[model samples]
Target: MINPHKQQIIKPKKAVIKWLLDSDPAIRWQVMRDLTKEPDEFIVAERKRVATEGWVAQLLALQDADGKWGGVIFPAKWASTFYALLLLRDMGLEPTSEQARKAVSLVRHKVTWGQEHGNSPFFEGEVEPCINGRVLALGAYFGGASDQLVDRLLSEQLEDGGWNCEAPPSRRSSFNTTICVLDGLLAYENAKGACTAVTDARLRGQEYLLVRGMFRRLSTGEVIDRSWLRFSFPPTWHYDVLRGLDYLRSARVEPDEQVIEAVDLVAKKQHQNGRWPLQNPHLDQVNFAMEGPAATASRWNTLRALRVLDWYYR
Candidate 1:
């Protein structure tokens, strides 16, 4: 006798899986592993192609001989080494690959915070929690020694249980900054485990998001920003409810009452065909088009949303 609940949980939409599998190597690799539960051998084979083909390959090819992209770091929009490294990380590139190793090394030696604080090295990080958070993430993901930087960010957490980039020890936290820092702390802890301080800090930060229900004003229960309802890919510094839920799902967080409203907002955005449209895309320079413009069914957004819902419903 089959368990009907288990069957319902495991059943997948075949058409959606087909559409996702037909995308770039990056997207296809994630779809196979996350949604389809394909065998390890098949997923590894597809993931290997990401370094040599399509947009991921194009971005790798754009790396300069000196190891930086666009010959400068930061302030160059999406064309600099900072954005390039962030993009590569998002594409799930292998941190130990030849290109990635060299790029990480170059960033360590060549890039600096640019005279803002005696030109601190890339991994040393500057004062802002938002910037330091990104540095921690990129450094840890690419195998840089970011322990000191991680400690600094953890200390910067405010009494409110979150971080604000505008000023350290602010009475309140900014959603944008807190999310970025949370992502960084999560990456650091994943790469190098056994730090109880980091774990506690991450939980507090999660509570900060949960207390406000991810998008509402805690005091008034009003939606804080209409833009938080829109979905976007490669979000950069922006914060959205979908992005927040996706992060929570990645962190293996169990569903909580605080997340119900945000989850409903996500479900409400689904189209008749069970797809989510791209509502925003960062308008900046890049290697190539990763997804179609806004208003179209976005493979990136759809993949993220589906997996998020899968975790939520299960």
Candidate 2:
């Protein structure tokens, strides 16, 4: 059982949750599962709404007949087929749904990485591990073929146990790239129990982040970037402390002393009403705004932070 006092410290206030429940289905579905512990029937009903209503529905409706969004695989930053699938995955679309399957099929059969790669985008993947990581995740989550891509990504891991898009010239791994790869590997593993190589690579990648304390420089123990301290939604490919901690929780890793500082930073950001504010939104064009403009109290960030704390304190 979890410690009662610790639970109280991390639990969201009723008003905060009430506010969350009243929000879009994308946010509400996660809140129900992660925070509210709502019954399966209720959670399923709310999740089904994601396919038919609100932001998730709006995004899905934008899919072109060719099954690509914006008529391109990697179109504008946020409107491309890759990003569209990523957003859908984030929105908790039922992967097995007919519409979801069709979209995945289109990417597999119709989409290519262009003349550069001259192959199926999801299967072959692109040059950057950051992009490949996300592709691996989307492919695995949405039932596309990712075996070759997964092997390619794992083979590209740096000696430091992480990945960087700028690999050959700079062997050092990047926080942003590492988090993306971690999300991919984890998603693949959860969907299909694969080989030990995948697990080993994933753990090493995790250690890469852990060594830096999520968002710090190992050499000086200094914060890497000020923006990393700011929490955001639909993190895309960025790395922030909250994103790191939330990934750790999803991977079922226990809290460690190395993460204490980042954990403390998260706790301090909570509003008095037991909510968190959206500090930054990615500059990329999105299908639609999931939360309000920045500096407003954010249900996405609040739910993520609360869950991270819940896992840490438990």
Candidate 1 residue runs with Cα over 4 Å from true position: 1-12
- CA lDDT, candidate 1, residue 7: 35
Superposed model 2: Cα runs more than 4 Å off: 1-8
Candidate 2 per-residue lDDT over residues 203-281, each given as its tens digit:
9999999988888898998888999999988888889999999999999997878788788888889877778899978
Assess candidate 1 and give its lDDT.
0.83
TM-scores of all candidate predictions against the true structure: 0.93, 0.94
The lDDT for every candidate, in the order shown, is 0.83, 0.85
Candidate that scores best on TM-score: 2
Worst 10 residues of 1 by lDDT: 1-10
Per residue, candidate 1 scores C-alpha lDDT tens digits across 193-303 of 857999999999999999999999989989889999999988888999999999999899998788888887787787767578999788687657788889999988888
Q: Give the TM-score of candidate 1.
A: 0.93
Best by lDDT: 2
